[model samples]
Each structure stands twice: as structure tokens, then as C-alpha cells.
Target chain A: MNINFTLNKKSVTIDVDPMKRLLDILREDFRLLGTKESCGEGECGACTVLLDGKPVTSCLVNAVHIDGKEVMTSEGIAKEPIGKLLIDCFDETNAVQCGFCFPGFLVTSYHYVKTDGEKNLNKIKKALSGNICRCTGYQKIFESVMLACERKPLMNANER
Target chain B: MLDINCQYKSVEVSGKKEINMKFYKPKSLLELFETSEKIEGKKYFLAGGTDINVQIKNGMIKDEPIIFLNHLTELKNILQSDNHIIIGALTSFSEILESELLKNKLPFFQNSLKNFASPLIQTTATIGGNIANGSPTADIVPLLLILDAKLKLFSKSKLREVPISEFYLGYKKFILKRNEIIGAVLIPENAETGYETFYKKIGSRKALYIAKLAIAGLKKISNNKIEEIKLAVGSLNEYPRRLFKVEEYLKNKLVNEIDFADVEHFLQKEITPITDLRSDKEYRYRVCINLIRTFLNQ
Candidate 1:
């Protein structure tokens, strides 16, 4: 099946099996390797991506579903201002360890900062609850996102 | 770069095995029924593709044609009428949570389902898929059963309404026919008003864990006498069902005068929980009794 959709702000088309997973399509067809695949099932958020501005597990999304839809992987998010802010915060807080889960975390946290952008710990925990981290105990990750939320308003003002 | 190369090689090997499956995307609901009728072998509807995609990766579904239903926009809205709140079957859980109408009317449902399989899964898993899959442990089933929800079953020729309680015949077995698909779910408005609502999902973790056992309750007590009550249990029987005998036994009885021991006897008869991989039978039964006791005592 030939599927045409926007990938990371770019309009692209691919002829692949419609039943193929979005995760596989990104990594194999498009070579967007930032989205990891820890669990082939939807249990883990390692394959999380933005499908039309909503976070969804890529492994559970079929290639056919992405037809004419907008998809953004962590690689695309990293180029945005909010994504850069989150990365700086994560770097400052030393949140990366082993870093297998960081890409998924980055995408989910970027979403939180862009949409809700609250400094509340409970809300942050709930928003990132789907993505798991085996390293750093998640405290540093929370701090990094909270840092980004606190700095996001300032960044927006600067952009204006 | 080395890791990428290793992963790319594995994808090629798996891609060859998965390419045999065929996918059909119908432009309209009518086309869907017509296309499905022409297919000879087992075919599955791909709405949201949350469960079906996972089953495919696990090799449970192979070489079967999947009819894509996400494009059927007609079956994806939450509308309100004079007497009922009509929810299209393909309405995702996230969409339901964001609905102002549901939040205002069915606050209990919106609040309870906040932890339905994490925020990521909720974005793609539809309410119809949850019920159509007929899993006994489905998070939405117990809530729908207590809401007295009715399903609008659509076929090529006609549409019929069936109460959700009667929709299930056994474990993973439904009264839904081959040509029929769940069109919408009808929940009566004000059905939950002036009643105390309770929902508890006991799982291994707070998110991304299947329910070991779940209980949903609605009670209307007047002057310490039980006026109306509805209770349902999931993951504790062949299918999620209402505790009709228990509800009947407690109706019109003074709350202080009721004997829980007798109520337990009635509950034991209705639910036939078995030992499974997710939970133990004895534990499920005892926890259900305790939870029921707690709901009533409060």
C-alpha cells in the first residue's frame, strides 16, 4: 500500500505494507531512529510519537492510520524551541542515564510543556506516567520538565 | 550508527513475514459492509488499531484482511438528545474525557476512566473497540453496565438497539453478528443524578496494567433506606454483569438492618470467577466482597 502523510513537518510518501507499524515505518522507511522500541507492544512508551498533536504509542498505530495525518517523532521535536528548552533542562539536571528511554520522555515532556505547561509535580507525574525510565529514578526527569515549564513563558516572551 | 544498522536488519527480516496481510480502507460505512461481505475468510475491523496491532505483532492475527474503520467519521461524535447522551462507538477515551457534556452529566464516568490504560493508549483506543473485543477485564465494560447503556448495532439492512448487559454471551463471545458493527452507545441522561457513584480498578500498577478485578456501584439512599441500587463487577466472571439478585435483595431495605453475610451468599452465586494468569480466583472473590461491603457501608 502507498501511504502519504506529513512526517516531522515534511510531506513524504512511502509504499509499504499498510499493516506495518508506524514505529517500523519511521525507523526503516524514513530512518527516524530517535523513537525507540523497547516493548513491541503498547505497554511501554518507548515508541511514543505525536500523531496530529496527540501522543500515541507508535507500535500500536498502523501505517494505514497515518494516511493524510501529521506525525512528529522526537527527532522533529528536538528542533523546536520548546524541545530545545526541555533538552537544556534535562541536561542541566543530569536526567539522562543509559538514555534508552530519553527520546520517548523528551517527546512526552515536550507535549506537557506545550499544552498544560504547569509546574505542578502531580500533574507532571500523571502526564509522563506512560513513559518509564529504568535509570535516574524519574526525580531528575520530573525536575527537568518542571524547569522547562518554568522557563517556557520566558522563552515565549523572548520570541515575541 | 552501529545500533541503527543492527535494528534495520531486524526490520527487514520481520517485514518480509508481515507483508502477506491485506488491508482495506473503505470510504464510507456502506462501503465497509459491502467490502466485508465480499471477503471470504476471517476479517477484523481496524478501529483505533490499539488491540489489533498488538495481536498482530504477537502473531495472533496473520494474513487476515483488516478493514480500516477510522475513516468512518460519521461514527465518531458525542451528541446529546432530549433524554439520552449518544456517543459514537469510535469515540476515543481521550475524546470522552475532554467532552464538556460528559463531564457535566456523567462526571463519575469521566473521573473513573482517567487512568484507563495510560494517556498514550487512551488517545487511540476507542470505546467501541473496548466493548467489541469482549474481554472480561475491559475497563469500560463495568462502567457501561452500571450506566445502563444501550448499544446501537448497525447492519447493512437495519439498525437495532441492544442493552449492553445482553450484548455479551460468554468470554470473548458477543451477540454481534458478522455483518453487524457497533454504531453508537446510548447512555440515558440524568440516570446518575442524585446517586452516589463508586468505581475502583485493582491493577498491578496505577497505569498500563490490566485490571485484576474492578467494581462499579451507584446507590440512591433516602433516609437511610436503599431506594435504588446498581452494582457490577468485572474480571470476576465470564463477562462483566450486573449483580441483579443482590440489587433486588437490598432494595427498600433499611441500610442499618441489612445483613452482609446473606448479601455475600447471593453475590457468590452470580459471579463465577476462575483462577487466571492475572489473578487468583479466591483472592478475586474475597476482594469483591470486601469492596462491595465498603461501597455499601459508605
Candidate 2:
């Protein structure tokens, strides 16, 4: 089956099984390795990606679903201004440890900052609740998002 | 014979781990029914692919044709009729949560489902899939049962509407016929008016956790008497069901006069909780009783 879609702001097409997972398609076909697959199941957010501006577990999404849809992996998000700002905040706060789950966190947090961008701790906690991190106790991760939320307006102004 | 207009492709991924499956994307609902009627053997309707994808990866689903239905935009809508809100079967939970009509009219229903399976799953998980899966722990079932929702079952031959409460025959067994798909869920507008609504989903942590047991209730008290009441529980029985007998017993009775012991006995008869991986039967049963008591007593 041939599926055509916008991948990371680029229009691309692939010939693969429609049943093939979006996660596998990104990694194997496109070599977008930033999207990790910790749990082949949707339980873990390690495979999270933006499907038409909404965060979805790429592991659960099929190749057919992505046809004519916009998909932004962590790799694509990293190039955006908000994504860069989130990375800087995480770096400054030392939020990452093993970094295995950082890509998923980056995508989810990047979404929250881009959409809601609230500095409230409870909202940040709720927004990133799907992503799991066994290290750093999540305090620094929360701080990093909160810090990014606080600086998002300034970053946007600079971008303008 | 399958519709000639329907497009389908059979593909086998060549590798160490190979999967051979035929995929069909029907252009219209009529085409879906026509193509489905001609297919022999196992096939699945892929709507959000949240549950089906996991089942496939776990090797629970293989060698089955997956009919893609997510792209059927005609079935993805939230419209308000004169007396009801018709939610398309393919409408995702996230879409439901975002609907201003649902939020304004069925605030309790919308708010209670906020903690359902994390934000990520909610983005792609459809309400119809949840009910059709027919799991005892399906969070949406108990709420829908309490809302007195009706399912519009669609088929090529005819379309029929059935109350959700009567749709389930047994565990994972539904009255839905083969080739008939759930088209829309019709929820009566202002169904919760003049009643106090309560919903509680007991899970391990919160987000991304399956419900061990859940209870939804709507009680209308007038002049210190229970005017009307509807109650439903999930993960405590073979399927989520209304406590009809208990509701019958409590109607027109004074709240304070009702005996707690008798109510517990009635509840015990309706629900059959079992020990499972996520919860113990004893805990589920006891928590259900306590939650019911709390809902009524308050």
C-alpha cells in the first residue's frame, strides 16, 4: 500500500503495509529514531508524536491513519523555536538523567507549552501525566516546563 | 461479490518478523457494508486503532483483514437535535471532551471521563469502540447506561435504535448483529436535570490506569423522598449494567427510611465481582458498596 503524508514539515510517501505502525514507519523507513518505542503498547508515551497538531501514541497509530495527515516527531519538534526553548529549560534545570524517555517528554512538553503554556504546576503535571520518567523524581521536569512556560512569551517575541 | 469501487490492498512485510494482512478503505458507509458482506473469515473495523493496534502487537490479532473506518468523515460528528445530542460513533474521547454542547448539557458526563486512560489514548480512542469492545471495566459504559443513551445501529438492510442498557446480552456479547455497525449514540439532552449525578472510577493511580470498579448514579430527591433514581456499575459484573431492581426498590421511598443492609443485599445480587490482575474481588465489591452508600447518603 502506498501512503502519502507530511512528515516533519516535509511531504513524503511510502509503500508499506497499512497495518504497519507509525512508530516503525518513522524509525525503519524514515530513520526518525528520536521517537523511541519503550512499550510496543500505548501504555507508555515513549512513542508519542504529533498527528495533525495533537499528541498521539505513534505505536497505536497505523500507517493508513497517517495518510494525508501531518505528523511531527520529536526530531521535527526540536527544530521549532518552542521545542528549542523547552530543550534549553530542560538543560538548565538538569531535568534529564538516563535520557531514554527524554524524546517523548520533549514532544509532550513541547505540545503543552505550545498549546496551553500555563505556569501552573498542577496543569503541567496533568498535561505531562502520560509520559513516565523513572529518574530525576519528575521535580526538575516539572520545573523545566514551568520555566519554559514563563519564558515562552519572551521567546515568541524574539522570534517575531 | 464485493463492490468494484471499493479499493483494497493485500501486503506482506518481508523481514524476520513478517505480517501478511489485507487492508480495505471503504469510501462510504454503503461501500463498507457491501465490501464487508463479501469478505469471508476474520476481519476487524479499525476506527481509532487504539485497542486494535495493541491487540495486533500482542499477537492477539493476526491474518485478519483490517477495514479502516477512521477516515469515514460522515460518521465523525457531534450534532444536537431537538431533544438529544447525537454523537457519531467514531468521535474520539478528546473530541467529546472539547465539545461545548456536551460540556454545557452533560457536564458530569464530560467531567467524569476526563481521567479516562490518559490524554494520549483519549486523543485516538473512540466512544463507539469502548462500548463495542464490551469490557466490564469500560469507563464509558456505566456513564452511558446512566444517561439512558441509545445506540443507532447501522446496516445495509436497515437501521435500528436500541437502548444501550438492552444492547448487551452477556460478557462481551452484544445484541449487535454481524455487518451492523454502531452509527451514533443518542443521549437525551438535560437527562441529568433535577437529579444529583455522581461518578467514581477507582483505579491504581489515575491516568492510564484501567478501572478496577466504577459507579455512576443519578438521584432525584424531593420532599425527603427518593423521587427517582438510576444506578449503574462497571467491572463488578459480567458487563456494566444498571441496578434496575435496586432502583425499583428505592423509588418513592424516603431516603432515611431505606435500610442500608437491605440495599447491600440487593447490590450483592446484581453484581458479581471477581479477583483479577488489577484488583481483588473482595476489594471491588466492598468499594462498590461503600461508593453507593456514599452517593446515596450524601
Per-prediction TM-score to the true structure, in the order listed: 0.95, 0.95
Question: Candidate 2 on A1-160: residue-level lDDT in tens?
Answer: 7789999999998877777789888998999899988876788799999999988899889887898999999999999999999999999999999998899999999889998998999998888888888887689999999999999888646551
Per-residue CA lDDT of model 2 for B137-163, tens digit only, reads 999999999999999999999999999
Candidate 1 per-residue lDDT over residues B1-298, each given as its tens digit: 0000011111332564423555677788888788888878788888998888777666777666778888788999999988999999999999999999999988998899998998999999999999988778889989989899999999889899999999999988899998799999999998688889999999888778889999999999889899999999999998898899999999999888989898889998787886789999999988998898788889
Residue pairs of candidate 1 with colliding backbone atoms: none
Where model 2 places Cα greater than 4 Å from the true spot, the runs are: A158-160, B1-16
True contacts kept of each: 0.72, 0.70
Model 2: per-residue Cα lDDT at residue A156: 46
Cα RMSD (angstroms) for every candidate in the order listed = 4.4, 2.8
Q: Which DockQ-derived CAPRI band holds candidate 1?
A: medium
Q: DockQ, per-model, please?
A: 0.55, 0.59
Give me the runs in candidate 1 sitting further than 4 Å from their true place. Answer: A158-160, B1-19
Q: For model 1 chain B, give the 10-residue run with minimal summed lDDT.
A: B1-10
